[model samples]
Target: MKQALQLLVLIFSLTVFGQNGNTDTAQVVIPGRYNSVEAQAKPYVIMISADGFRYDYAKKYHAENLLKYSNEGTQAKAMLPSYPSITFPNHWSLITGLYPAHHGLIDNYFYDYKRKEPYAKSNKKNAEDGTWYGGLPLWGLAEKQGMLSASVMWVGSASDAGGARPTYYYPYHEKFSPEEKVNKVIDWLRLPMDRRPHFISLYFPEADANGHHFGPDSKETEEAVHKIDQAVGQLVQKVKELGLKNVNFVFVSDHGMIKADNENPLEIPQLLLDKNRFDIYNSQTLLRVYVKNPDEVKKVYKELKANKTGGYKIYLDKKFPGSLHFSTKDDRYSRIGQILLFPEAPRIFLEKGEKSTAGKHGYSPKTVPEMKATFYAWGSAFKRNITINEFENVNVYPLVAHILGLKINGPVDGKLKVLKETLK
Candidate 1:
């Protein structure tokens, strides 16, 4: 048994060391879609989620290393985030392979009718409770199968998502800087082999926060982009210096940013739910107005649809289009508001006497191109210098599972086949 273990370790060393520094058609041995012992011990995958990073940001900012890596490895032209493309939802989608609706993180914040509670990013209690988030996340899955995993402030990392926390994790801390997070990941990487995580998840929020405070086109956003690029450069240099073999590195974003203006905000003469005797829980981009009297559902929907104008629309939850894949038939069909509204780029939804200015996401990736995220992966298992035009972001969960040779059993919407073409 010990000899077999030693052999596995040697295979891992060869897989990583054999392909070091060979930029020309270089490849490393990976477990080829097989969940064998060799596959389990072969590679280390590090996933970095750069908040609100648009697909074009790489080229727009001339981030040399990102551009060069994507050019040399596998990159998706655009990664289509799930509907209501907000932070928590899409971030969860990337790890769970389920749409926001199924994952139950429908928006950055939403109301849960059954529990008569509201789930918001600010609420630590709800955020840490795994019950609210249905599907399994990659880190939790790793722990379940006796593999070590680490997370650095990635959304839901604090949660007992699949009934366990990562072997190593730094809970979301607002004061944490990009440099600090990167340094910590490097620390985790340098741990002894038995203590080191096979999978690591990292998050950076400067660009996303700046993109919201200053529109995506502003100098502030540009500088923030550069800062993150430098941080990534540091990560690559350190990894290469450590001579970590067969390490798979993925740099991606939850969703993209769009320039938003409050100049001609969508006007709602009536706070429909309030006017109709109801409580309201609303996110900047989506609203879930709880009707005190269920019979008024139609009345509320009608009033909202009637008062809505440019930049936004109102619809009954029941009548929401199927293409959005937000149907509640699978779960929580009743939790969302009876009425729904979505805003277009350059449009902000404000109540009768509201005001704002900032960039935003949550818009459909289908129309507002800026809302589309980015995906890039390089190392042993992925194809080199390949570019796939576009792909659904949900498939990312499966892609990670495939790279790790994990056989996940829970139901997931993302199909492995969708991402197979991009892998070796």
Candidate 2:
């Protein structure tokens, strides 16, 4: 058992290290950009996302620095993730103030019937393409309003979403050390007033990676949480040394983690696997079926619905639960599949012979407590020692916008009023 655990750790190390080989770590600076006079006067915000960090992780894992900092300012009981609580969707939701359906990234991997193309997070070309994303992300909003922004590695930051990427950004890569990332933020903060980024985003992948490989309750995950806690402490210390005023930090996670029923995984229904009948996009937690022949939709739905066993729920796209905001009415881009399958907590769909990860997420937070993410804010902008009830992740965009004094260009699902009370 000890040898097996060591092998898993070594594999995880190699997976992360392998991505760094020959990968460019230079900061990409878009020339000819400067903060407008109004933007220059605004306060600074550093939004940090520790992917897969659960709501209770700080307390549960004894993340001392995070608990300390949050206790000093504001900490929410929990932060609810958007429907289909996965990495790409929720990150975009947090940044754009829109639900996944509204933002056009309904899932980490999904087929767009209109575009006749697939948007997979692992596909570098499409992931970097700005056109695939919708809703003006916070970085784009800042840039549009003449505030320079920087991103160490935030989803959609590397793309030209809303016709502008962050003025300073590094395309997503796993090679850079955590210390290097912190120093880069310090460098950006140290730039000349006009050139410095007022809005900066930093991302950490350790918790999520370890959680998936070793399960949320494992010692590996606890250690990963501690690493994040230390990194946060280091960042706060370094930033304080700079004596930057009105600089606030908002920490969040895209979604939480839960152990999966890996030993008894559900296999896809045989009827749905026929190539001529359906195009299936499976994410373990959610299975989307796009029927080829429109007429066959009812027949297939009936067969699958009647034959479906335990551990999952099936819904036709039009009849999907309205609360999830993933029903047909909310699909702005018509990207959602015709039929949807959502597995209950700890249950996931896996084909025969395919291995399941020890940990999994993407369940609806409303139904599964394990899907709830994290949110904590501290620094000059937030009220001290306050705790608020759980709120939707979309509200984060408006709160950040409010901090930076950026104007909301259009209607967004997030409302500043929801989080306005947390401010000093």
Candidate 3:
């Protein structure tokens, strides 16, 4: 009877194994020029993105301790963000090497063309439908390569989309403190050698938070950077303490911030405000409207196109003028608004009952220098003491893949030049 039971168990196990074997398909490997069996055997990677950090602040202040990695190792003068220069879209691009269209996260605010409901940035339930984010993030790629990854707080990281969940994830929790974020990273690093992640992102949006509250130039913003600097110090200390050698670290930000006075000088004159013509998303800077019946989107487009007072630009959904250094026209991502009103100077976009205190960024990337994010790379593989200029954030995906010895799928908007020379 015992032998019979054993035989029966064996058959059951075999049947179960065979039945579910194909259910969890193997990860599809997308080959690339950079992808090779040899490239996959390099030192591991540690990527950190601090949202809303500016390049000038690091270059000028020198307070960013980790940013020194950019100078001492391989660095870029500034990282040009995707066209809109907002948080969600640009952060998604940095990881996927694809624009908002290709990666599929069009904006921080979701627009349901069907008008199902307003897409809020922090809404997790609605975000689960898969439209909130697009493409696979770097962490997913690392996991597929048979490596481990951990994301503490990165945009589009909170969800376990496409069954592409990280080995460890600390999704956006409002109650999480900075110390909690830092400690969680240290804990993840301390996991047994086999369990610890090889890819990680450490983010602190306090600077951007302060920028929105106290303006980028204000003391509060500076203090926020100082606090984050200490956070960086703690992270490096833990890395050393945990003995995570052979790890490559890349520190970056989504975009920079602009100083705003909150006063609206370019308020649309009553004559310009056709109740039927304008759906003012931002009466000051970002203006969106559905023109009156019989009025062409282009007619309103032509009017805004000609008016350049507030540093605004008008583009039909099809035409985003200039080589804004992004694949914005791609059909995969969210196309920017029909008319984009970029602010020229210190102006804030105002809404009903909304009060602006400090700095703002949703304007044209060209108009806001702060919209330019920061980039720095160091550790086992990066070359030392070099400064390259105006590296597009899109390019980072390929560069990172090269560093980690992974391959990217799909057509990439970023190139793998300039910075390639920096790596030894």
Q: What is the Å distance of residue 318 in model 1 from its true position? A: 2.2
Residue lDDT tens for model 3, 1-424: 2122212211200011122223432222223212234323456676777777887776455676766656678878788888667777788899888776666665555444444444445455544445556677788787777666777767766565544667677555444556677888787667666566667766677777777777778787788787777777677777778765677778888888887766564554343356555433442435444344434776766766565454344455556555553333564533344555555656654544445546667665565676888888888888899888787788888888787777776567767784687688
**Candidate 1 wrongly placed segments (more than 4 Å):** 1-40, 269-276, 306-308, 330-333
C-alpha lDDT of residue 218 in model 2: 93
- Kindly list the per-residue Cα lDDT of model 1 for residues 160-248, writing each as its tens digit: 88786787776555545678777888887786676667888998887787888787888888898888888888888888888888888
By lDDT, the best candidate is 2
Q: Is candidate 1 or candidate 2 better by lDDT?
A: 2
* Top candidate by TM-score: 2
Report the poorest 10 consecutive residues by lDDT, candidate 2.
5-14
Q: Tell me how candidate 1 scores on lDDT.
A: 0.74
Candidate 2: lDDT over CA atoms? 0.88
Could you tell me the C-alpha RMSD of candidate 1 in Å? Answer: 12.2
Give lDDT: candidate 3, residue 378. Answer: 82
Per-residue lDDT tens digits of candidate 2, residues 123-213? 6676788889999999999999999999988988889988999999998887777778898999999989899899999999989898998
Return the TM-score for candidate 3, rounded to 2 decimals.
Answer: 0.81
The order by descending lDDT is 2, 1, 3
